[model samples]
Target: MPTEGVTGANKGIGYEIVKALCQRYNGHVYLTARNAIKGNAAACKLRKLGLYPIFHQLDIGDEESIKKFRDYITKHEGGIDLLFNNAGVSFNECTQAYAKEAENVINVNYFGTLHAVEILGPILRYGARIINTSSFFGHLSNIPSSSLRNRLAARSLTVDGLCHLMNEYLSDVRNGVHVTKGWGDSPYTVSKVGVAALTIVLQRMFDNDPEKRQISVNSVHPGYTQTDLTGNMGTYTAEEGARSALFAGLDAEGLRGQFVWDNLAIIDWYAATPPKSF
Candidate 1:
């Protein structure tokens, strides 16, 4: 089974991930969104295309909503095979007007993703694949500011540390000090950086233990897909973007915790400057 969130998935990469999984995987797939209407609409569209993806209402930001989805999955599907953390938000143009960019973006993209993982971690089957939808913008090399780069590259980082840093960045943004102080450029960047960092940290954590030995967790850049998160100005289509995610989800054997794009591996930031495409 598969769990997809932020089902406003009306028409974008989220929808495309749903479509791609249906076409590729024969197991049960859960097409989830915060809105029931939108979730069903997207599922119905897939149904018309001869794919039978199930619709469930889920809000990654809400603990209750996440629990409800988890319970539904446990009762119906027993457990999940793949958990794709694809729900994200950005306030590029709008947050600038209100100066709430960091707050808004981190709440959805960072915290929301973690919340889903927290709720679903216990229910994931052995050998289950977890795909975190990160971005190239999340790369640390993109942040040229030295002070901010150092903060973003803090050592021995954990999910709690990452969450704390994101909150600190949000506070800076709201106080109108982050931009002037060079903490970060935008909430989107800060939140995504946290995501990418969280990806590597989680990889190390997941790979270290023998009990949690069957899980493979990884992150990927969908490679500039045309989606609402990008304001529809991306060069690639949602289907193209879902390619790497699907690769991570279904075919990623003996390859856990690797960040990828275009079906290839990405070089780490310490190894190079201003990372090139994988």
Candidate 2:
């Protein structure tokens, strides 16, 4: 049986994903949370329902936490067969300075996810499946500048180049010149754009890897689900939001470096406007 792992599984969509996997997947499920008590309690709830789930502490925002989880998994399971990068943070309203909020959101959402992928890349076995939880806002069209969108979607863009571009967005925002520079001020949107782009980069890396080849990486937009992140403004429940990711991660075929939507449909991240089907 292939082992499965999920980050930030204590509640919301992450929790629902773990629940679905525990019920359907014929393998051990690792449910990780930044808070140990919450993580354990979540796993215990599943166990009470006669479903088995293992708990691990993973704070994607913390480099040490990510590395520790990677080491533990490699030592015990040799590697993971499936991974869902479902952990992220978002800001609400206009409470803090744009720079401060952008820094916090970008750090946890883009750099943090990037670090987690980089650290765990070595331990991802061949035939592994990785689902990156992006958002509809991740689409290139969300960025106002056509040149910026093209640059991000360029096939020649390397991971280092992508990292540089992300920092550039931060720099522009910090200097109060993001609007002029064509990098929008929404850190959450930009971070998720990074994630959407990173999915493609990772897939290319896996395809090129001689030893750790045959892996699949894709991004999924969980919809405007009602979660703490969204301040419960969305109508879709957490379970509804988890559907597309679960399908994309566990059931979909030949979905390499693609973007998925809440309706279990493949999304064109480059579309200038949302599909009518949306």
Candidate 3:
């Protein structure tokens, strides 16, 4: 049977994604979290509901942790058919130096995600589906610099360039010059922008890959939802918020490198427009 894995699935939308997959997917679903105690607790809760989710520990911010998970998957499952890079960190306020906060957030949301895909991409089965859980503010327009936006969307841009671009943002943040550099102050939004961009670029690589894995990569904006990420202040619940990602990860057909809304609609991230209400 095909196997699937999710990151940061102890709670929130990630947990809901695992729950939905366990209920519907005709495959083994692994629910992973960075914290072993919380991860196991979440798995127990699901077990009470008669949903069995194999709990694994994953911390996207840590490269060693990711490599361990990758090796575990390779040994236990041979490979995987689905991967949801849903693990991320976001905060409404920063108590410490903004740069420090930016580092942590970007490490998990952007660089960490990039690394996860880099390590796990090889294991994705032929015709596998990969989905990144982006944010509503992940659009290119979130960055005020037209030049940076153009660079990000340039056909010549590669994963290396994406890494450099994000590193530049961090340097600017540390120097307290991110605003002048055209990157907004919100690390969460910027990192999510990286995720969205990663989705597009990854899909391109997959399409042109000599291996011809025929994998499809896409992104989903789950809308503002109530969860730990948002301090439980949102218009929707976690279960409802997960629907968009579920659609992208499991149900999307003939879609590759597209950004989708919570209402199951795809849009142009290049265009700066109001987000559609689900």
Task: Tell me, by TM-score, which candidate is best.
Answer: 3
lDDT of each: 0.74, 0.89, 0.89
Candidate 1 lDDT by residue in tens digits, 52-81? 888888888788999998898888878888
TM-score of each: 0.90, 0.96, 0.97
TM-score of 1: 0.90
For model 3, the run of ten residues with the poorest summed lDDT = 91-100
Instruction: Name the candidate, 2 or 3, with the larger TM-score value.
Output: 3
Instruction: Find the 10 residues in a row with the least total lDDT in model 1.
Output: 1-10
Query: What's the C-alpha lDDT at position 7 in model 3?
Result: 94
Instruction: Give me candidate 3's TM-score against the actual structure.
Output: 0.97
Those runs of model 1 whose alpha carbons end farther than 4 Å from true positions after fitting are 1-10, 95-97, 269-272
- lDDT (tens digit, per residue) of candidate 2 on 41-74: 9999989999899999999999999999999998
In model 2, the Cα lDDT at residue 258 comes to 94
**Candidate 2 to truth, TM:** 0.96
Number of backbone collisions per candidate, in order? 0, 0, 0
Model 3: per-residue Cα lDDT over 1-278, one tens digit each = 89999998999999999999999998989999999999999999999999999999999888898899889999999898999999999954847666788898888899888888888877888888888999888988888889989988887778889889999999988989999988877888899989999888888888888784489888988888999899999988999999988998888788899998878888888886646666
In model 2, which runs have C-alpha deviations exceeding 4 angstroms?
A: 276-278
